[model samples]
Target: MKLVEVLHMNGGIGDISYANNSLVQRKAILMTKPIIEQAIRDLYCSLLPKNLCIADLGCSSGANTFLVVSELTKTIEKERKKHGFQSPEFHYLFNDLPSNDFNTIFQSLGEFEHDLRKQFGEGFGPCFFSGVSGSFYTRLFSSKSLHFVHSSYSVHWLSQVPNLIEKNKGNIYMSSTSPPSVIKAYYKQYEKDFSIFLKYRSEELMKGGKMVLTFLGRESEDPSSKEGCYIWELLGIALNELVIEGLIEEEKVDSFNIPNYTASPAEVKYLVDKEGSFTINKLETTRVHWNYASNTNNENIYNNGGYNLSRAIRAVAEPLLVSQFDPKLMDLVFQKYEEIVSDCMSKEKTEFINVTVSMTRNN
Candidate 1:
């Protein structure tokens, strides 16, 4: 799959749309709220600019993007009062790949602004949001134009699939069976792309500008740790079942690998230092469980959890899977995938290591 062309969350508010199925991402957003609020407060307390600019990089299509914008509005209101001045007009930029359902987020702006007005009592500064289309792996804005930047559940994705996965047969992502060379290839790609990301962002941010980033990461140095690889491991098993049943070919499975990687905290700090653009003020991890569907937590909920997980995975992975496997087998593939996921979750806890880092642009 062309990462630029098809790497978007399912669009629209339909049942399968990312707007509906993005609860996991929403959780990540909530976890970062305090960190983001604190950064924005500090920026206003120090810089005290009459006009402020902020960008949400890799902001997929969902209400959570508005949630970030809304909370920032609140933070600006509080900071303005505490600092004895009116808040600056906010220029908000929401960025994602070109294929992202930007319109889903864009369509909600009228409502977002209205709610902000109601909460801020109509005395708020004018806020404008624009959808910018591009990869975050390269420059997206002008030099020294932004004050605070935030990203959630992104930055782990590579610009493209690592080129040396020819030996990573029958696995869609990093698996135990993947050789050391395959892992090396993926990490090397991450190092190059992320270094470029930092260089560009450093140029775009004003002195002392702050950024908050949160995404999937691992606790162990091993990239194939349970936190990083188990999801894909089970997914690989699901695909192999289909292969056994003659639903999909083994060659197709061998050819696909997700353009994403999970790093340990040490790896992350190493990259930050290597890039030489930002100082890591705080790096932390939170464990979130994708257990029984919270909306329905019963014996049956375990089954529901698997279904929800499948849909969530489907929403993101369909583009890649469909591009390779026949569209006719989509339902069957996921049905079997759901069952396997359900059985596995019942046997053990399914969790992710969510990594968050707060950084300051070097002066």
Candidate 2:
């Protein structure tokens, strides 16, 4: 599939939209806030640019999109007040695939700006906002134009599916059944795409500019570990149920693949060193339960976790599923998905491994 055309979070403010189901992503942003704050402070102090240029790559439209904006501005505002320095003018850019819901984000700008001014007061930034539609794998900004860059729950998405995935039949992502060659192909594609991502960002960032990135990754050296792949495995099982019911073609399930990868910390470090553009200041990993209430004593909410998890996954994965399956069958698919996920969660612990790294553009 053409990822640029097919890959995007479900848009708008409806029940199934990403805007409503992105609590998991929001938790990740908050988890990495300390690193982001330090990156912004270091960049601002080093150069003290009057106009601070910031870009949020893979900034899919949602309340989560501006969550990053609030974090950055909050950090800067505190820094300025601490030093008694005048506030800097902020130029913010939000980027995503051209098919993203930029219109929804645009419509909400009035309230967003109003809230920022009211909270930060008169000395607060005159922050300018705009959208750039394109792939981050290619050049998206002028050379040395950006001062601080932030991307969350992105960069794990490959620019395209692996060319050799024909052998990866029966499963949509890396699984225990996948051949050794199929696993290697996934890693190779990630290596190539991530290298280019660093290369382009290095070109766009001013020297000493800082970046904070967070995305899905695996803690185990083994690529097929359940920590990272089980979510998709449960998804694959749901699709197979549809195939058995004759609702979906068996061949379609055999041919379709998710154009995403979860990397290990060792693998990420290897590519960063090989790319030769940035210094890795902090590389840390944290795990988030697929069901946020998994640890709570509330059995009712915990039991309903599967239904909630299904909605969250659907909001993000529906766009890709629709491209290959009948749109009308989506609800049926997730209903099966929720049943399987709820059953699995009751027996085992399931979570997403999030990797957050802070880097500096080397001179």
Tell me the TM-score of each prediction against the true structure.
0.96, 0.97
Q: Which residues of candidate 1, in runs, are more than 4 Å off?
A: 292-294, 297-303
lDDT (CA) per prediction? 0.84, 0.90
lDDT of 2 by residue, 42-111 (tens): 8888888889999999999889999999989988888889999899999999999998999999999999
Candidate whose lDDT is highest = 2
lDDT of 2: 0.90
Worst 10-residue lDDT window, candidate 2: 292-301
TM-score of 2: 0.97
Q: How much is the lDDT of residue 260 in candidate 2?
A: 88
Judge candidate 2 at residue 232 and give its lDDT: 90
